[model samples]
Target: MSKISFEGIGEVAATFACEAEVQAGQVVGLTGDGTVGPCESGGRICGVALSSEDGYAAVQIGGLCRVAKTGEEVTPGFAKLSADGTGGMKKDEAGGTEYLVLRVESDGMVIRL
Candidate 1:
């Protein structure tokens, strides 16, 4: 397995749409207004999923998830994908602070942001 970084609207868009631009196992760092928006269906940028089986255009934040999806889910408004020292960033302060724990696998764990 390998790790990758995805930034800006396009990369996030590709992941959200589950397009060929992205694939499983690639960690995406999302940053863009289009990557976030309000969804009447799920409220706020609650989660991400594929728009369709063959749609290139991914729904920014909460566009309207039509399919039932299951995968590693993350939401922090904006972030950068890193493969070391947990799934999130390092602490700038003296003490060690942490967020985003990396999990290898789970059958069906539910999380909220």
Candidate 2:
């Protein structure tokens, strides 16, 4: 699998709302139903609800459905934001990994990578 670094993203001040359109009524510390990653690697961290405000905003490190208990896939989404406001998902075919489609509506800036 292809791995991306979360540290590359700068820093963002926001919280998570624990709600996802993909998942229904299943809320966790960080909803896997939505997208989370560094805002510098080409990803946008929005609330995905009403507006891009409120809730815990996170970075889009990578995308993986099922919960990773083994820790092998325990790569949690980073919470950093880059001032450049450039971040998004990248297709890594060489790594046999497809960054799932995730759109959040938190309170983070959208950085274009």
Largest TM-score belongs to which candidate?
Answer: 1
Q: How far is candidate 2 from the true structure (C-alpha RMSD, Å)?
A: 14.1
Give candidate 1's error at residue 54 in angstroms.
Answer: 4.4
Worst 10 residues of 2 by lDDT: 66-75
Local accuracy of candidate 2 as per-residue lDDT tens digits, 1-87: 225433223333333443333221111223245433223322223322212223334332222222111101212233232112222
User: Candidate 1 residues 1-113, lDDT tens each?
Assistant: 32632222232334343334432222223334333222222122323433433533343232212112232343432322222222222212233222232222232211212
Top lDDT hit:
1
* TM-score against native, each model: 0.23, 0.20
Clashes of each: 0, 31
Question: Under the 3 Å rule for N, CA and C atoms, how many clashes does model 2 have?
Answer: 31
Off-target runs (Cα >4 Å) in candidate 1 are 1-19, 22-47, 53-106
